[model samples]
Target: MKLFNFHTHNKSENYGIINIYPEENILFGKKYSCGLHPWHYSENYETALSQIELLAKEEKIIAVGETGFDPKSPVNIDMQSKIFVKHIEISEKYNLPLIIHCVKHYNELVKIKSQLKPENIWILHGFNGKIDIAKKLVEQGLYFSLSENILKDIKKADSLLEIIPTDTIFFETDDKDYNIETIYKFVAEKYSMTLSDLVKYIEINLKIMGI
Candidate 1:
């Protein structure tokens, strides 16, 4: 039963899509997802955006982002949306899934999704938002990758796991240093499923993402 991590920041991990900044060098032979994070947006962002598009052509580059809106970021929402749309274009051109990092911008994200109507899968990574928001994103055809928050509040996680369709769910460590198996164990117990069965369902979800 191999554990699959849909997103992670730990580059040492052998199993998962490792998140990389556009300025970082690609570690050959490892699967990665690259983009210019909203928080990292700068004056020379066009250079970084071009780099991401170029990386998108690589076979090991499996996804387009960890890019999305962050209300707290110095970059304005409009600027963030502009960059996000560029990432969406890269995802579509490469026919790869998009790994999103949204912070208090679900409404904007949903609105963008509605406007763009992208065919590539958009996965919201490190989700710990309200259940209603989760349901709303689910309605918009967005998938989710639950992370360390699940370990912090098992009860809330239980409610979320129950509502999220298994086929649209994935487990990840993100930038956390914990074992991904812990998340899988808790979710399996909640759903009354064996670890292997949980893995099988996640595999099916990955297939939907064209992994």
Candidate 2:
């Protein structure tokens, strides 16, 4: 069974290598969620934002960002929110699902989202929060893209797989050390699903989410 890689930072031939070059998709054999990371936030956000817009317009750029608020770090929270809203606006404008990397700032995310009321789908990558928070996000109609660590609780995983609507679910391996296919295989096994079927399922979800 093949897998759909929803988000990755690796260089790729499909999506141009982000920040490294433009007009070249030289890194072959992988799909991508190429975008600016929030931690790499810059003062020249508007300039970088323009470049990001152009990059996102590329055919291989399947997702808008690894962008979102990070509250704990030293960066000014106001500045972070401003930059993050830009990514959200781009995702909304382009009709692409956002690949979010949120840290300690879900409430602020909630506020920004309320004001924007984006039609574009928002996905939380590498999600491993508690069940209540997961439920809250699900209630908000957000998708949670799971990873290897989320598989430890067999019962919880099974429950989530069974109860969560298929269109709101996804999987990824942002992990550079492990191959994505292997990660897919592991998750697929947990769900008692074929890997190719899983990929198909996610693609269907992407469509439902307007990606």
Number of the top lDDT candidate: 1
lDDT of 1 at 16: 83
Q: Give the TM-score of each candidate.
A: 0.96, 0.79
Candidate 1: tens digits of C-alpha lDDT, residues 1-211: 6899889889987878999987787777778999888889755588998888888875658999899988766788888888889889999998989989999998899999999999999999999999899889989989999986867877788889888888899999888788888999999988899999999999888877778
Model 2 backbone overlap count: 4
Looking at model 1, residue 62 earns an lDDT score of 90
After the best TM-score superposition of candidate 2, give how far the Cα of residue 90 lies from its true spot, in angstroms: 1.1
Residue 100 deviation, candidate 2, in Å? 0.2
Structural RMSD, model 1 = 1.2
- C-alpha lDDT of all candidate models, in order: 0.87, 0.68
Give candidate 2 regions above 4 Å deviation: 12-31, 58-60, 152-163, 179-196, 209-211
Which residue pairs show collisions in model 1?
none
